[model samples]
Target chain A: MKRTEIRLAGEGGQGLILAGIILAEAAAVYDGANAVQTQSYGPESRGGASKAEVIISEDEIDYPKVNRPDILLVMSQLAHDKYIGDLRPGGTLIADTSNVTPRAPEGARVFELPLTDISVNTTGRAIAANIVALGALVAATGVVSKDAIEKAVAARVPAGTVEVNLRALNAGMEVVRRPATGSGDAH
Target chain B: MVGAGGVRLMQGNEACVEGALAAGLRFFAGYPITPSTEIAELLAERLPQVGGAFIQMEDELASMGAVVGASLAGLKAMTATSGPGFSLKQENIGFAALAEVPCVIVDVQRVGPSTGMPTSPAQGDVMQARWGTHGDHPTVAFTPWSVSETFSLTVTCFNVAEELRTPVILLLDEVIGHMREKVVLPPPEAVTVVDRKKPAVPPGEGYSAYDPGDGDIPPLAAFGDGYRFHVTGLLHDRSGFPTNDPEEAAYLLNRICEKVERRRARLTMIESRDVHGADVVVVAYGCTARPASRAVRMAREAGIRAGLVRLITLWPFPREDVARLTAGARRILVPEMNLGQIVHEVESAVAGRIPVVHLGKVGGVLMTPEEIFEAVKGV
Candidate 1:
């Protein structure tokens, strides 16, 4: 992409900040592209809204903040309700069906998946939900190669849990490949 | 040139540690504060592995004091802090300035007059970095807009501090300090490393610690070295003894000021683009330069002759360059996170020849490119 802005929004303690850093690393380190990752958090550590913005481009990124996100991935209802209005006209909204009820604006494409459920079922823990969401984000937007994301995850996650996180990532991609009955298009 | 080479994604605070290590920094003492705590945490982890020392002091005062002590013992030392901590460090910073101790102080600024916002960005320390100390002393401050620049400028701050024998400030805001980006650092051997000038005279060979005959900077001798000399905050003569005479005190203070002021031309660093024939010039630094650059591009695309001057070296403020850049422009726009700190300097430089506008944002939110574009169009 010439220049693409991505926003990952969720409540604190969901690892959205780590997900954002991994995505930016995937593009900048593994994909040989330029990327900048910035994050904002509420005063309280947990339960409050947390947002991470990543801007990727083939050239230098001028403005670091995401004014209009081309892709928005949200895992909480509050994040979805707050950030859905900031998506560009033809942007793509990817939300976790387990928590967020999809409310796509006009000309916006919506994709829903059970990101947290898949992580809990595949890895027996909900901590890897952010990695699952990252896998889906890569598959849907093609922002970075799958190999790049996998390498970034391997380098970022703590040792002894890399396998489980990788499994969670692949499970997420599998869900995108086979959409559920009521789920919208994986576009 | 001696680091883990090639391209890697790193945060700004991490880059500062890497840069300090590359500059042969052997000692670090700091107190943890938001937006700047990462630098201390990483240094604590990395310094010991590199055969250096790192100390987490009880507070900012002790941190600065420890850094100064370590520097006097002939190690390149550093400390990092944010708003409140920076305020606490002024006295010791002034001590370093008056005592002619070479050290680097990184102030990763957060929103505040007094604990305003912890995790937010602000350039409010621009004035403090220059004049926070009580007495009149020369100041050298450098600011970077990106992660890679942070690495290079951190090294530069060390070099300048050593060469000039004074404290240097690497000013950063929360936005640049917290952001992550890709950077390709040069090999250790490829980077220029500067060490302080050591004493040439042997012990008891009429060696005076404060004596620099024809030069403003005296050769510093390590404390434990055979060449024993005194160091104090009081104004002293070339023999290293405190002076009560007004003439001797004035000479000592003027020597400190002249040491840096005489080298201002070499110390100033600025990046100017398309400033030759522009109708408006945007002057910005630190994180605000990122959006100011975008605004300049947008204005140019819309057929407005807008140029940009990004100050990489903030203190020893680039007055000559600012005057030359705005000579042909009708107006100048300064967008800072603080309420008109740097704008006042720009106005003084322009001397009312051009209408200088200050676009100040103090709410912890960065000034957006759209806002700057509108300001450019209005100008």
Candidate 2:
């Protein structure tokens, strides 16, 4: 498809904002797609819920805000409740099993990953969960290459944290090797 | 790519960025907000690439503060903000006016008295841009109707600031800020850049930053140039120190306001389309000016003699031309994103000779062409 809307949601400090920017920069600067990313957060930057929406297309984007998502990734319980209903009938919902007990609408496919635990143990940082969740989404949908996501992450995160985030991405991919949820239903 | 001027498709916000750069702007400080954020984002990226310093300030106040500071340091500095942020920068704007600092402030107006709509467009700041700052100081504000005009007016803003020694406000609505159109980048040699006049006397000689000179404007010596002059918002003498004396204060204030007022010919610019032999005229600026032109064409085609007068520079008000143009017309219609701000100016210029009408909409919605046509029917 020439157009895709991806929504990333989680609690604050999960790097959701940075992940959204990385995806936007990758699409615009690297992949040559017209990408516009918007982010909204609660009052707090450390504890409350946060969401970042990225819209990428071959043509120009008019409204930057996303009313519905083609792919919704939720990293916490609040995120799951906030966005699970926003998924279209045949849309994909990727949830971090350690935190999100997702409830999706009928015909909606849900893929579960232990993103929080993997990020915490692999990177020794709970803050990199957003990066791991992105890797899981890339593995499932293949909208963007894994290497592209890795380079985007490295380019955005602090210089001292790049290697750790890469380890977290690999740890997330290992979880994808095992069958945890629905795989294929083209719509 | 097929338009007048090597036209390239670009957004209005990007055009302002290019205009600031072309005007020899070397310093930019701004806090990112919606609708207006693209200007800062573009400046932050393009400024460094062009050997300019771009700093994202903590808030709009600091952003304006840094701009004034950098300008006093002898660099062409500017800042951009939307509604709520614009409110925060008002005090510094007044400060720049009272201090007679030469700089440009771009207010990419959005909806509200508060943080109402982040993405939508509004033109409610018309009166605010004129009177938001608490003072009787003179002002020069310009509004652009197209992407290309945004660049042209911005360059003019810089030139006016240097020539008049005042802070010029570029009043742009959100629609113009987000709209994309074709514009050709001007060649470097074709653009005329104006720099502030420097002190002619030696360092030790009596060089006042606020003294009256040959043209009633003093030569400003840049900061850190061995010139021991001070700048403050309070009334000061020619040597640039604080003074509470009434005569000195009045003299300083009157000169600052009168200089620009006396030179009205150099400050006012207006564009009229098909105004001759028309009974009805539409006065508009910014994004509204674009659709107003079309509405005038549609009206003319419908057998209603209609024309458009677009304000390229709004502050000097184009009073004399507007008065003359509307004097013979049966009616004048003003359509703005706000309710009755610029309409007041039109009503004043007409002075009851012609029936002045207002078509206004508030809270980020633009006045439709059909609505404008209906308003013009009253003539």
Candidate 3:
């Protein structure tokens, strides 16, 4: 199988790092594929450009960073502005509509959804925005199976918050299943 | 014993803790630092459950000192830190080396001079790790690149330290320390654990702590085991007492280096990929090896004769194995996170036999595969 590079970029407190780990685990552990997850952030624990990258392939993965992401998930305007150009030609872009004004790249399938709003409406927790983003990513791109990601989320998230996080995840899938706002399937 | 035996996703730092525990690490004293703090955090929670001890020392100096003290009490002990903290521990690390205390010091390398970049990866500490502590000493530093290799290499670090009765270093970069991957963990019983040899003679029955007795390693007794023997940083004689005689000091120093240096056959480890007759061999360690390996594969795909030599054991400088592996290559390329640290070692090791190319990078950034492949293609 061809290698799939995914980049999740947002503020540090958005929990995107844990989301990346879960997504990689879904592919590598449950799906029985090779996946490597890496992240880079500022020294502070919050309010900086944070990114978590995952490379999934059928064979051994090398060159762990995501130079050109096949799928780019951006949660905030700063992340979207800095990383929108990094989306590969004919790649998939999933942006949070409420926070980002994405100028969709050419020949890309862009799904601009209200990710933070979905999390707040579904789970009554704003921190589940990352989980909602993951759900949208799996639903729109089909890179990782819903079943595998569900198992990963169940295994990785805190026990008490699992139900709310899963609710947020399914709500994310729901938005894509419905007609996404500003959705362009140019691919 | 931390969890049931199965395949799981883990980070390099967390895996180090599990490997140390499997290797019978019973006591840990460390100051938390970025890129290496996860080991201390996890060990703090897990050690007490296993009836082991964990202490967050006041500083890296105290942490290293405590590790030495604990190991002298006969428990397999360890301390971990990043480059800044690693510098502070050098004095005690040297003392442990001369005194022959069995302990493990883990340095998760970050860009350094004086905290050049916190939480960023760099391989700048290669020379410092080997010759960091004052004076001449043999170093056994294990550099593991991947998450799974981090586990096995950490186990080997403990075993080598215990068997040889010396301090061992587990060197890691920030990338490998923070990177997470799928690792199939082995059961606790499957791992081979080694304990330091103890004195055959009773405490008072003419037992000399530093006497090698025709062997390089003397059977050392724990401090409180009814055996009272001297251990000092000054040159010592066979009876463990400080000796002013030049011959006795030379004997002590020579034996200490020989004990570790002579075990090169057992201590050296490298992973060579497709270097039998390759034209260019890329030599790298720690986090840099990931891209180096990828570059080799890319070069091969592009019909270029490129290979990789991932040096696992960095200290005692595996020159022989390096020379042997890259003998067929026309040129050697070393890409380090530091500005030409390991490149010099390679240049000296090859000794102009193979034309060596140096590619050094800094600034808390990684050498991408494209850049490394370009270096290979340029040759």
Best by DockQ: 1
lDDT order, best first, reads 1, 3, 2
Tell me each candidate's TM-score. 0.98, 0.69, 0.97
Q: Which sections of candidate 1 miss by over 4 Å?
A: A183-187, B1-5
lDDT accuracy of residue B274 in candidate 3: 95
lDDT (10s digit) by residue, model 1, range A106-187: 8887788889988888899999999999988887889999989999998899999899999988877777777777653565
Better of 2 and 3 by lDDT: 3
Looking at model 2, give its docking quality level. incorrect
Q: Write the per-residue lDDT of candidate 2 for residues B1-379, one digit (tens) a residue.
A: 1223353445678889999999999899999987788899998889899889999999999999998999898889999988898899999998988888899999998878799777667788878888889978888999986667888888989988877778999988776776554356788789999998899988878888988677788888888888878899888887789998899989998998898889887788888877888899999887677557767877988999998898877786788889877666788999888778988988888777888888888865555566677777766
Rank list by TM-score: 1, 3, 2
Q: Model 1: which docking level applies?
A: medium
DockQ-superior candidate, 1 or 2: 1
Q: Pick the lDDT winner.
A: 1
Report, for every candidate in turn, its global Cα lDDT versus the true structure. Answer: 0.92, 0.80, 0.89
**Native contacts present in each candidate (fraction):** 0.67, 0.00, 0.64
Q: Candidate 2, clashing residue pairs?
A: none
Taking the tens digit of each residue's C-alpha lDDT, what string does model 1 give over B1-379? 1113487888999999999999999999999999899999999999999899999999999999999999999999999999999999999999999999999999999999998798889999999999999999989999999999999999999999999999999998999999998889888998899999998878778888789876789999998888878888988888888999998899989999999989999999999999989999999999999999999999999999999999998898889889998899999999999988999999999899999998999988888999999999998
> In the order shown, what is each candidate's alpha-carbon RMSD?
1.7, 8.2, 1.8
